[model samples]
Target chain A: MGRRKVTHQLISDNATRRVTFRKRKDGLLKKIYELTVLCGLPACAIIYSEYKDGPELWPNLNEVRSILNRLSELPVEKQTKYMMDQKDLMNKMIQDAEKKLEKEKMHTRAMKLGLMAGSNDLITDTDCSEELARAADVVDKKLKAIRERIKAVEAGAPIIKRD
Target chain B: MQSSNVTDCTMRKRGTKRKIEIEKRMTKQQRSVACSKRRPTLFSKAADLCLLSGANIAVFVTSPDENSDVVYSFSGYSHASEIVDCYLNNKSPPKTTINPESAKFWWEEPDLYRDCDDLSELRIIEDRLMRTKKHLMDYLEKKEKSHSVSKSDQNPNNDSGSSSSSSQIASDFGQNPSTLSPSSLKIVSFDQNSYSSLEPSSQVTTCFDQNPVFSVGSESSSDQSRYLVNEDSGFVDGLLCETEEENNGMRLPQETQTQPMFTEEDQSFWENLDVDDVFGLFKDDNNLEVPLQDHSSTNEDDELLIDISEYLSEEAMECPCFS
Candidate 1:
């Protein structure tokens, strides 16, 4: 019969623990070696077992240290400073939005107060729409003027106005 | 007889279903044997993956012994540390997120955000003012230069009309005359000295005078120069350039815009990997097995004769999805 499936966990029994440790450790190293060879990747694993006085280092200690040293030498930005700058930018944006909201609120309040003082009558949708329509007409006229000026500039017309 | 066979089969099934209880403790011999077996298996798996997908890995495990810590290291390359370094180097600089230290309670908060917002708005206003001023200065400089040059080329009788039109054009470009004072004057003087230093020859000056639009776009051109230096100092330039691009309606090149997105994609790949998932691939029974040759044989021949091209390519194809 096939041996029972192995679940990865530590062994508590002294004899079993020692046996499992040796088998698993060897298996781990073999797997590492196979993966490194088959995939053509640079890989290393360091295993220290209680059974051995010295740790089992694949491809040796000097090489691993050099790899680690090269990693440490890389220029990565300081995490703390990066976080701080982000926070500052976000806070600034939030504050700007808040100020804009406050200004809008104050403007609405002023408009309401002015209307109340000017007349006892309430403002209707028609009045608001008429005012908006007038604003839109003015904006459209300005847009047309800007467009014409741009076209004139493109055509190399001599400048007539100073402002 | 058939009933007896069925009962026997049932008993076998029950025995197989029984949980394989592993002892909590192990003897010294068993631990040694297990460690030796597992260590080799781990290295082999690493080697396989490395060959298949061109991945680099380093595993370092420290086990506490009776006397001292035992260090076991497996590496795909000759030097294990190099792979470790490669792994570390690939990491993106810490992402900019919330900083708890800078956060204050509502009562303690100041008007710094609004102040910053105003300052930024002022900067944009200042920048536009500077551009207009630069354009005016260029026009003035050009007019003087053109007049001097055209004196020989064209009739001096028409100078009044042409000079008037040019001055009008320069003045028309600016919305507010008051914006010319204060910091803009400082920028104009600074720009003139810098511009003069860059092109001292009369020929270049005449060429610049011909293209007034060039001076209008000089702000972004100057910023692009700063961008090269900003790359060395983290992503502040990136943020600045984005805002500038929005204001100017300019689009950065495709390569530059797509680069960060690619790095972010890679970040997800690394961040999502767990230790269990990493080793689970090796434990897969269905995977193709490569024969474990003696280490001595491999050492004797510096090069491996086994051509894993077919298997490597197949595995390589599958790597990106898993990674």
Candidate 2:
């Protein structure tokens, strides 16, 4: 096992605070310095602590007030929804299509196996109870496709079945 | 005395006005207008700082919806990727070995094969599958019976099929009935030993008049000989229409055929049919496809506190009913 040695570096809080204030102040000024420098305006900023005096006072206080105002103003809430029905409908259609695709495959296999050709034309040609037979044909065609597909796939490899 | 009283009233009014202004300054709502004014100044100052100091600052503000936040970043100036890199470099964890039962065994590069514990699932599946398949076969047969009679009923001339099957049916001697499995090579015999609950006749009868069938044109020639020839003059036209329908089906790819909207289909079906006859035929018969009505309504905040079992049980249990 390899253990690495640790090193400690310390700076006094008062010193760090002084350094931080100086750095942040410089940074803030550096932010505004561009505009002030370009405009060549003699602008000075003075920040007075609330803890120091009975009455609070700041010089070039408008800038500090503006910064504070900007920070405080931000929007929070946004939009959300469930849309359960549309989601369910989409899922159902997907399932329906999958089932149909499988049946068509199976029917084709059965046909190849010298079985009956379960073509939808069976209903149309018959001049049957038109709508009822048509609907049945739709279901039959869907089932046949699914079965043929299942058989072909199962013969070759793994077959995934939907519950 | 009158002059002194006037001076006192004027001073009191001025004091009240100053108090109101001070109160406005204390409230955040009152400060909102000032805040609006300050935001532009802040943006300008930030842009100026970037241009002046040559610090590559990137400030982004996102819509409140997302975790994508306002990022005021600098590549070298502020920490971004460097902190994560430091954290990662500090300690390297070894990969842990997976348990044999875990799904990871299937995903790893090396093949670690194990027999599935639930071999019983196969038998259960096989049983269900056989039942379902039997149902399907029965449905198809029922559909075929209904299909033949339905056509003959609609257009009586259609009875003169292209083959001798009809004559054989009318003869009433069950000497050579239709093959149990239309496909002769491989037949899945219904085993009477295991489950006698599933009857072929029961399954076949269910499909009658409920679901009709359609055919593809290429398959027409193969089955035309199966139909019995007719003595009537109208029989020839019926066979021709069958061929034409088969051709129509052949023209469109299965999925691409755009199903007409209900209003459109309803109109067309009514327009083509002898309304009295169509209604007469289906008056007592149950339909194959019972359309399920859409329950969704355009309602806002129609929230109901339903029990989990009533609404979401199908999905939580992974049951097929919901699907």
Point to the candidate with the largest lDDT. 1
RMSD of 1: 45.1
Worst 10 residues of 2 chain A by lDDT: A77-86
Those runs of model 1 whose alpha carbons end farther than 4 Å from true positions after fitting are A75-163, B1-323
lDDT of 1 by residue, B242-317 (tens): 2233222222222211012224445555565567776436454554233332434333232323455555766786
Position A12, candidate 1: lDDT? 36
Fraction of true A-B contacts recovered by candidate 2: 0.00
lDDT of 1 at B8: 86
lDDT of 2 by residue, B1-323 (tens): 99999778878786465421222234444344433343235344433332223222222111121232221211112222232222234421221232323434223434322444566765665677678789889999999999988977887844344234433332332324343122211111122221233323221111111332333323423342222222232222222112324223222122112122344545655565565676537443344233444545323212222345665654566876645
Shift of residue B193 alpha carbon in model 1, Å: 99
lDDT assessment of candidate 1: 0.44
